[model samples]
Target: MARQRFGLEGPSHTGHDVGHWDGLKAGELRIQRCGACAEWIWVAQPLCPSCHAFDPGWEAVEPDGVVYAWTRTWRAFHPSAEVPYTTVLVELPQAGNKRVLGLYTGADDPVIGSRVRGEFESAPDENSWPLIRWSAV
Candidate 1:
């Protein structure tokens, strides 16, 4: 499942999250880092809440990670998503241990601390956008 599965359509890529979407389009995982304190910032922010640095820089990080947490959705959180899809919060070791959420795809359910890797999946429909999905390694 992609972000569009929830009708999120990902980001507009015109504002704070531009670097993130651009990186995704380029098949890279880029996270914002504080220029001053080197704090990793996910969900994009204009300034570092940790050090109050203005405008963080985008840096590519390894897509390899591990499942920090996971849940199998049995409820229809959104109409576009089929029931019983797995969603996971993956912690990137190369990215200051920042955890990011994504749809999980694999032969088996994800377990906590399971090794995983992220990959970009092309949009399935006009309303969707390319998004990263995680799979067990």
Candidate 2:
């Protein structure tokens, strides 16, 4: 398989919670949840930040959400990343208002509380990691 290429070289993904990326590669949105307290966790953690439980596991979640916050970047932090891209904090109502951050691909300006849905973009290489982009719904 060709190495996955998402255009931009992402930051280091090495860590315990990196399994979330595997879910993306499989076209699923997975998030960590506290097995004990059942609280949703973001940015993936080995232990639940809320209940202090260990061995948190992943669960598939609905892709639909509302934009809680957003911002557009004019500067290219990396040469491969295009400027003027919008990043959004999406609140997943199904997941106890837990929020996930991703790039917004819609043409219109992002509005707080706007409905959005996740769209997984596959890497140029079949084996490369996939990404989740959001679109206005």
Best by lDDT: 1
Q: Estimate each model's TM-score.
A: 0.85, 0.84
Local accuracy by lDDT, each model: 0.83, 0.78
Q: Per-residue lDDT tens digits of candidate 1, residues 40-129?
A: 998789899899988899999978999999988888867677777888999988888998888888647799987998888876786666
User: Global CA lDDT of candidate 1, please?
Assistant: 0.83
Q: In model 2, which residue pairs have backbone atoms overlapping below 3 Å?
A: 4-128
Candidate 2 Cα errors over 4 Å, as ranges? 1-14
Error of 1 at 118 (Å): 1.1
**Candidate 2, residues 20-137: lDDT per residue as tens digits?**
7777877888888888998888777778989899878888887999999999877867765666778899999987788988888865789998899998887767545678888898
- Candidate 2 residue-wise lDDT at 3: 21
Global fold similarity of model 2 (TM-score): 0.84
